[model samples]
Target: MFNYHTLYAELLSSLHGSPLEKWLPLLPEQINQGLCEQRFGDLADWRQVLQQLPEVSANKIELKDKIQIDGDSSDNTRAQIKNLLQALIPWRKGPFFIHGTHIDTEWRSDWKWDRVLPHLAPLENRTILDVGCGSGYHCWRMLGEGASRIIGIDPSPRFVVQFYAVKHFIQGGYHGVPPVDVLPIGIEAVPQNLQAFDTTFSMGVFYHRRAPMDHLRELKATLRQGGQLVLETLLIEGGLGEVLVPEGRYAKMNNVWFLPTADTMISWMRKCGFKNPRLVDSATTTLQEQRQTEWMTYHSLEQFLDPADHRKTIEGHPAPLRGVFVAEV
Candidate 1:
């Protein structure tokens, strides 16, 4: 059996005696269910990849500027590390450097981080929840910013294993477990009205939820009073009350349901009882920001867009214009 006893224990241990202690009873089952082989046929293969990772100790770890692990390693060992990591292809949210190998992922998640970081309240000693945090790239960055604890959740089993693959090097290099983890679950698994975290991040997720209001409420429920909510999602340019409800697919993504204007999103946040809601940054995603790479050999933003007109998606909807919003509950 593919067991994650240590991972589960770490999460439960961190929540023990904390405000999130109530979550303990529910997590073990959820984690097991999320990783069940019947649910993810490739689970065994992914687990094997994790086990195959070269036993390398990082001499230096840098996450403040980028996800990098530098260790005195020979060329052969670096090549071995690269091969093991390649099994988890389509890496969407990182540009991690391990030893001498650069796993340049599809998205330059660091660029997005740069835009969102300046607007965030100081992360020092904060407890954070990152929703849809694929592979926990930004979770490490949050820890780098001095967060006391961080739990990033995503449903993809592939992403879960990818996170642990990186964690293998990170934890192996250190004396103790870092206060960061990625759970193989979704936001729905989170206890309602837990009000536990100091800050909650729901990036690139709002538009996918069929019920945007419910999603907003769920995000708010995770935070304690006066806690901050940082959200980033696709948007259209329009006034309040205007939203783009895609009839079919948008940007080759079928799950996308709603793309609201910045004003509309703020209004939605207000309706969910969030206070002081405001747009912090807005920018269109570019080919340079997300594209096919050696590590992520899959079609990306360029293929999703209209080749003749970069302003629109192939399906004729407006191209991805993302907005970052911050509010307090």
Candidate 2:
């Protein structure tokens, strides 16, 4: 099995020259600034003798409740896609990915590049909106995958600029890729008049909202009765079907709230007017098992932070969510 931690470092190392390079270079420099002190790089040679570091636990968020998702017995593709998304999860939280691959710098022949292609749903001929479109990786992927018109929305000015930078490198203009238009805005920015989208996908975003019901209602308000919404967020195992974040702030990372369970999510979706809302796919069977046993190439938000920032996890949530939700309006 590939050492997930090592593989992540290697993958990130290869992304050194991309947009993400800005943040990582400092990490190595700080370690070696005074004399040869810091110790982290190199594909092998993990021990060339360097400064010793304090002990740390990978666990960042406190589990108010254990995560549990209703696994689809037949969708093996879910696992594959989760592996693809696993590479991006670490970037969603603090100390974001400061390497290029997060925004599609080099090519990955076997993984995520074309993996989401098959699930594109021939959306090219239809209208689609991608919310919380950080770096616009998936937004760009949708265009190439066949989305006739695509709107990429995000509230991060930096992320928006970076997304455009990458898109410009590929398509030459930000005006509109003939049918693809990327807007740097929040989910609430989607006009109520544009009430229907053939499909909508929001990843790592739903949980940011503390009021799951309100979030669902807004999503439903944006979708036409027949439109489809695909949501992916954290879920606790066999726990509270509906979790209320009375004490937690939605604005945890950015200015957004955090939610709890997927069941809580599904309940909100149903309350929002979506019928036949289904948990068609998911990868984390048990949060504890996956966190403690998996020898996979990935990490949680905590792995990417320094001690000062690491202690802040006590105020947040950590439920494994690296998949999709297929819902109909």
Best by TM-score: 1
Candidate 2 yields a Cα-based lDDT of 0.46
Model 2 residue 116 lDDT? 35
Model 1 regions lying over 4 Å from their true place: none
Model 2, which residues run further than 4 Å from truth?
1-120, 172-178, 240-258, 285-319
Q: What would the TM-scores of all predictions be?
A: 0.98, 0.54
What is the per-residue lDDT of model 2 for residues 113-158, given as tens digits with 9 covering 90 to 100? 2333345446646667778766565665566555655666676544
Supply the global lDDT for candidate 1: 0.92
lDDT at residue 321 of model 1 (Cα atoms): 98
Model 1, residue pairs in steric clash: none
Give the distance in Å from residue 93's predicted Cα in candidate 1 to where it truly belongs. Answer: 0.7
Candidate 1: tens digits of C-alpha lDDT, residues 98-202: 887788999999999999999999999999999999999999999999999999999999998899888888876776888888888899999999999999999
